[model samples]
Target: MKYLSICYIGFISLIFISGGLFIMSINFLLIDFSLFIEWEVVSLNSMSIVMAFLFDWMSLMFMSIVLLISSLVIYYSMEYMSEDKKINRFIMLVLMFVLSMMLLIISPNLISILLGWDGLGLVSYCLVIYFQNIKSYNAGMLTALSNRIGDVALLLAIAWMLNYGSWNYIFYIEMQKMDMEMFIIGGLITLAAMTKSAQIPFSAWLPAAMAAPTPVSALVHSSTLVTAGVYLLIRFNILLADTYLGQFLLFISGLTMFMAGLGANFEFDLKKIIALSTLSQLGLMMSILSMGFYKLAFFHLLAHAFFKALLFMCAGAIIHNMNDNQDIRMMGGLCVHMPMTSSCLNVANLALCGMPFLAGFYSKDLILETVSMSYINMFSFFLFFFSTGLTVCYSLRLVYYTMTGDLNCSSLNVLNDEGWIMLKGMLGLLVMSVLGGCMLNWLIFLTPSMICLPIYLKLLTLFVCLMGGMVGYFVSYVNLFFFNKSLYNNKIVMFIGSMWFMPYLSTYGVIFYPLFLGGYIVKSMDQGWSEYFGSQQLYKSLIKYSQINQIVQNNNLKIYLLLFVLWIIILLSLMLLM
Candidate 1:
């Protein structure tokens, strides 16, 4: 515990000081000591790769937040996993994850970035399967394979970067001045980012990854792994803007945001609801980024990280008290027993809904304002508003089921928030979730954008919040018996509730047919026709030849002469015909 705390604290202090100094200068700090560790390879025109790090406002700010959250998560885990035999190992994995994320944040070179990127994928797979259950194993495989797609994309991007004679693509972000090679690189990199961020087609892994421990979820979902894509896109925004790829991303990201929001509303698992919420937020970040609002995306990324991490900590406390029951249907009246945990949950939920003066307000509100003022088409506009409302809808439903509902657990259940160490961890992020946005806005956006919208446009967020709250209350709490109807088993309910069957689409839907075909091919080709005609036939012929040779050796000279004469006669007949 002491060792882990010291490591986390030191990182926190370093990031804080570094971010402070960078902000004071308002200029990027490039730490290129690659000459000390540079190397040349003969394969690709003497290509040189350097271990360079960049310390800009974006990188420092993000690094500080990652370290801060990681510190709290490690502190939290000291209690959450205290009863387990592998607590030290858990802490070690957490530390390694933090190290990888830091490497990703600081590195400016594409090659260096892959080190961190692959490290994140590897460590996350290990952490996901830490419990060593079938569920954990399956989830780990899905997560790792899903992320491997991104790793491959990055590798291809590096190969393409060879066109520029350098691996540090950061220096050439304005490659629009060069050639169409930028287009291919930009597209591949964006696709890589999408996979990492769980955008659109690659969205299933995030929810499945909830099979991991809650602390890992808080760290990975909130700040580190998922946000890596957004950060990468932010770095490359100059090259992506005004391109066809940017417009495509804008459309897909908005759809993803909308899909996740709708999915969360129908979700029942307590942790999954939070996971889907994280997905929605990622989509939000991507959409704003696709619209060329990198700073806005960055702002929301930090704010969302704080509150979401806190929210997960609160959920973890509840789950721990409930003895690992994650189903909301099995949990109710938690506030009656766990007041502190409940309060933290409520605060985080409100912040997620963009409650005024809270962490999300400064960033989320600004994003809505900017989107409203922008000249987006009707489809994107509707997606933004509808998705915003869904956020409120799911949040309210979650609060209703877990906090205010009647007692639903077994009579013998004993649940309470009593772990001091866990509470301490929650407090750090809780404070940040409450105040981090305001502080970040002050530091990062020294001069806030001034907007002058009409009354309805300004009130759009409020209207959605109110409507969503009413809908959530009605759907979750209304006495359906009074209406003489039961929609619990409805197919439409099941469809939306199951994330539009995206889990199947991403998992079994992707592999089942291919695996079935592969099994068929293996049976027929490897063991059937090929074996019969090639190996089996060859074996039979070899045995027959050996038998003939043995017979010839054992037979008299007359038999050998007769066989040779017959062979020669047949050969002469074939030659005469030819």
Candidate 2:
């Protein structure tokens, strides 16, 4: 069974090698190979929907990261999901997801990308519902439905591209400059990306998706599934730059970043907190991409994949030790009992908070510096800085609750660092989380992002990071002078913690009105007038008419004889008149 994890790692190594080969030949790597199977043509427009594979730096780099994170996740799952009887099935599903992601990465044609896109949606649904519990079922439905919106949006994009006589969006991206139809298509693509990435209204699904196994969370949320949307937008960035749709996405993504950061501060569930952080990072990637820094966004996406996956694996280790408890309140003194796990958690957390020289610093610092150099409005600027601080705020609080305090659990609670398999899985990511950013920064950009600004503007991120860390540590970790109170009890805290009631909005708010209207329509049309006027009334009226005619024809011999005499008299009178 342990060999299985090794086998997967070996496969990932092969992929890494292949990607390295392409990386070496970067000069000749501008290759697009379309394999046409010559399937029966369905349209008169001569649309040859072929299987296309695009090999370039972007696709290859992204593929390497995906496989790297996936291998670690699979190895982690060997121990994380060890108790499950269907571990084989779980591993296979994960492989399917990775394969689908690869398909998505290599496909330049919109029509063929559907295969990968649809594969992602379906396999994710399967993984989400793998637990087969009520919570998993609900979360799976939300995940599926949210992604279905993107699927439909993609379909609309395909329909719009029909007028261009080709489904290869890459080829048309340049010609679409200043085209109104292209703008609309770009807007639809943005909408699709938004939903898939869980921006704003579609965000509830990300946290809810924690109902899945932690390994699934690590892979899907970190490297593969959620990033798919940002990747899509990155691929289509040329068409979207300076477009109205890009501006709209920029605003929304900024808001999402702010909202998620605030929400994370208010959260108590450990996994959900990390999940929210992932959401915040996603928003960051999306916002940067919207700002026309596709390379920066891609770099961050790769770096985030490393540490974020490591972060989830650490969370899983803690949860496994804590008897499946996800609440931070129930955890304490873990640093003493499980030094290895605690160290990894701290490292990942620091990297996430953009600590200097770590993986995140390379990409995150660049993003902030780039933002500071841009000409964004005050609101967007404030959101970026405030969200950066909020990140550290929640992170520090998490550290306090989990790693720093006295033992908060009962005497019977058992905690240990005995999960060697899981530890082995995490160790790989721990190294990557430490060095992945630097390596990616060097390889991808080949140079630093040049920015010259006022000292105050330059140090803005550092200031926020320090301030957030101080506040977080002071309020949560320090219990000597001040009494610690639960922010969850406050009305404002509840609002922000509940993600501005976005869960309710995306779930009940979205479904309630439509459901109410549907019920009304059913009552009024299906059960009321349509039934009465269509089938019920018509049948009743025919029955009544039949009854009346039957009564008239039955016991009326004198009436019949009088009618017969009148008819004969009328016939004779007509003949005489003629």
Candidate 3:
């Protein structure tokens, strides 16, 4: 009861906070106002150390969204973690996670942002390893190390920003285009964003982080932690727009989008598939941001958060009922068993697929149309539409496996939607998932973006979606021969299925050579040559000298008699010589 009280308190407090922030954001938006509050911590020489917060429409709205999701996640976890012994600890970690995200969202200074950023990384690691298993340990390590790269990049950016005599980036973003140092800072910031958002080479950690509890997935991966990078880049978009760095980011993010979408199609783990989907959406947000549509990126980010969090919650309910089994192959006919969970899952999935009038459709459709209308290369165009199609492909495939097939679970397993607390959580996000797109569209964009394209181009998104759906459905039925074909094209399947070996590259590929080198050094130097010439040789020499001294000391009387004879001989020889 005490543990559950924590959830209630947090949920209620956060709900009130979220509502207040939302209203404040609206007022700020209507008044065209921003509040920047700065406190000087100290002044050194000519530089003033200050802590700053930027309360504009963007930050407030995002904070509201983050808190809303977090509140619901906490409410959901009351039931989800009810049986756990350490529920209080879990709740505390989650609250800390929320606080870290809030800090990251509101801070305008790089130093303050780093504090939040590092807090997020550290808290996420704790959350990932909450299960206290080998897999969780490995996942947590990978997540921590991967995010460390971004931390390093941010630190370097802060160091570079010292040239401007301030860590407050809001004041310097506009002038960034004019100076080489500013260009370097922008590049560093982009690199930091890439690692946080899990772009391409940095993407392995996002899916691996699914080893975390599903609630953590709902809060961290879906909305706050993963999106921190996107939010940071959104804030820095002014510096990146129309620059070579922006172009480079666009290319990298496009590839990330395509890769994540394609990888999700091949993935089987329920949580991992959703994680990959999050990665895909993040790529979408980032690519759009790099294209200079920061508002659209933020719009998509908010919209993605609602449905994705709902999706993860639905997944959590299903996983709990299924006795913790996560493989999609073992999940079938869930719609018949758990209607509410299934209904919410389907809604979230369709929204993810960009079905018309849903949350994802508004932002995703607009993004695709904007991409079509933009003067980008053919390759980027292919990537955008194709990745959109791939998203639909994976989503439909997931729905088919989990919701539409025969019951594939053990007969002893009894699955039902009995957890009302979890359902309550889902219900809140489900409403938002259904209507969040239209709501955010109006709130974020005062004037609609003018996107003009041909009839074919306009229909292209729909066409790819339909085609992808067909392929996804047909591919599921081919499971009978999947084994044989997979055996035949084993390498190809392995390559595509393993996120193009990104996990290997991030883990074994990164450590194997260094570990081998360290072993070689230990064997050849520490244990071999250095031991012989340094420690071992010195020990032998010392032992030999000690043994000689011991023998001479033990025979002191004989040594004195021998010395007397030698003295007499020397005296006789001296007398004869005289």
Q: Give the Å shift of residue 280 in candidate 2.
A: 0.8
lDDT of 2 by residue, 172-229 (tens): 8887768887887888888889988999889989999998899999998887889989
**What's the TM-score of each model vs. the native?**
0.86, 0.88, 0.90
lDDT of candidate 3 over 195-268, digit per residue (tens): 99999899999988999999999998778999999999999998778889989998999999999998998889
Candidate with more favorable, higher lDDT: 1 or 3: 3
Collision pairs in model 2:
none
Candidate 1 lDDT over residue span 66-140, tens digit each: 877887787787778777766667877888888898888877789889999999999999999988999999889
Off by over 4 Å in 3: 42-48, 481-483, 515-578
Per-prediction CA RMSD (Å): 4.2, 4.2, 5.2
What are the clashing pairs of model 1?
none
